[model samples]
Structure formats: structure tokens, C-alpha cells
Target: MPISDFRKKKLLYVFNVFFDVNQSGTIDRKDFELAIEKICSLRGWPSGSPQYTKTFDSMITIWEGLKKRADSNKDGQVSVEEWASMWDEYAKNPDNALEWQTQYLRFMFELEDASGDGTIDVDEFTSVCSCYGLDVAECRLAYQRMAEGKQEVTYDQFVALWKQFFTSENPSDPGNFIFGKTKF
Candidate 1:
């Protein structure tokens, strides 16, 4: 089956609200730079600090990978159609996910685990969501759903949900809240 409308909307949230950091209609190098700036700012990683430099480099690497996979037209931007289509292909054959895709997932999980305790607590989840311009209250609820009554989410559990976020079509899947609740 093709990508579901449900999945598409979630992907749009990522594309429009997350990756398109400059409110641009397409994903490009600038967006990645802005995102790096935001993340570093949120963490108070001053310029020239190890954290800042690492984040800047990591985001650029991720941008290169995303551009390779989604910039089919080679127009220097990844349009919404290309973004959704690339993900649609991944949804169909999740086991074939590229290293970059898994790398992105790991990066996001590490980003949200602010305490660095190997698990994500509700507070940590809400804080990162806020950094990304997501609704904190809604994020709290989403975190609860994702944690499934647990006090924290382990990296292993997060990896499982990450797969669900990409591959599952079920609306009730907790992984739908990976980035925050999707508008139905």
C-alpha cells in the first residue's frame, strides 16, 4: 500500500514544522543550519563549544544524507512530494532502511534524552518538544502515551517505536507521537 494519509500528515509536520526551520517550502542546507542553531541554542552550547561544533557537523551530515535520498530532482531542495515519496518507499521496506535513517533516529533519541541517563523522561521529552516549537502540554500527553505508563523510555524501547513511527499505519500506534501528536 501507498503511504497512508495519517503517515503523510505526520511527515508534513516534520517537513514543515521541524526540518523547514526557516518556514521555507522545501528542505535545504539552510534549514539544517538553522536547526543546528536552534538545537545548540536550546542546549546553551555556545559557539566554539564542543557541543555546538558537534551538533553543527552532525546536522550537516544528516542533511547530506537526506538530500541524497529525497532530492531526486537535484534542484538543491527536497520538495514535499519527494519527502513523502521517499518515506513511502521506506514504509514499504523498513528492513532496508539506510544507515542515515537509523542515524537520524539515534540522533533524535539522544537529543531528547537531555539527562543522558539512557532513558527519556517526561520532562526531557517536553523540553525537547518545546525546543522544536511543539506544544508542551500536548507533548506531555504524547509522552505519556509513548511511555505506556513507564517513568522513562529506554533507548531500546525508543528504537522499537521509531520503527513503528515509520512503518505502521495504525492510528493508535504510540509511535505516532514520536515527534508529537499528528492532526487527524
Candidate 2:
């Protein structure tokens, strides 16, 4: 489906948050967590909250899935260069934006599957946090929540939470342009 203009703007805000850490127009592993934290804060979610844990797990899962597809070199890590390359390739397709978004979700799924075993465990969740620069305490909280019955996060739940957290308070304001849409 074609993303609404609002969703496009919202997604853009998210993309910028992830891509422009330090406002340097460049993103690295360190910046990734900052971006995630920023999104969490904007959406009224505490970084270490159970709600945040589920959302973060979902995102990591998607990232890992996308990495498997984008990391053609099989290096086990997707660098900035690889990300750019993937984006470029996707942009050339007729359904460029949609494909980009799909890839993004897939990547998150993969990130959550830290063990590459198609399932996310507490250890795998923590490993994702470490990759994104989360400290031990923060990572622990995430696992604690999951172990306490939070379980795995589904794509729809993740998307709903993302919309709630990232969308601007002013319904009509059409806020930040991070990912390329507001309702993604």
C-alpha cells in the first residue's frame, strides 16, 4: 500500500534520527541507539520500560532480517556503506519507498533474532542492545521484561507503537520529516 503523506513524514523523522546522529548527516552503530532512545522519549516511552523493551526487540528483529538480505557480502554486519548501497538499489525500483520500508522491517526482525536461530531469546535481545550501545543495566531491563511474559513482539504491534511514539501531538501539524512518511 502507498504510505500516506503523514506516514512518509513520520518515517522520515525516524530515518533522520537514525541517519543523522550528532546532526552530522552520518550514522554509525553508536548513533543507532541514540536514535532509538530519541524515538522512545518522543513517544512518552521510558527507554528501559517494558513497553520500550517490546518495541526495541521488534526493531532489532527487523534489522537482523533486513541485514540478511542486504549484506550480500556476508560479513555478518551491515555498514553505513552497505546501507547506502541497499537504499540506492531499492530507490531505483518502481515501488522504491515501499520496498525501502519493507526492507527496514525485515532488518528489525533479524536484529531481534540475535542468535540467527529464527527466535529471539533474552540473551539475543541483550546482544542487540549491546550492538546499539545500550549499557548492561539497560539491556538487563529489556530481558527482564521479556522473561516476565512480554514474549516476542509482532510486526503489527511494533508498527502501532512506532506510530504512537513518533507521530506529532498535533494531529494536523504534519510534524518532522524523518523517515519519509508520518503513518508508516
lDDT of each: 0.86, 0.49
lDDT of 2 by residue, 1-184 (tens): 3434554444444445445455544444445456567546644679789857865765555556556656677765554455555544543452434443665545555555655566555565565555444565655554444333456545454444333434334433322211222233
Best by TM-score: 1
What lDDT is reached at residue 150 by model 2? Answer: 52
Best by lDDT: 1
List where candidate 1 sits over 4 angstroms from the true fold. Answer: none
- Evaluate residue 140 in candidate 2 and report its C-alpha lDDT on the 0 to 100 scale: 56
Give the Å shift of residue 6 in candidate 1. 1.1
TM-score, predicted candidate 2 vs. hidden true structure: 0.38
Per-candidate TM equals 0.96, 0.38
TM-score of 1: 0.96
Candidate 1 lDDT trough over 10 residues, lowest sum? 175-184
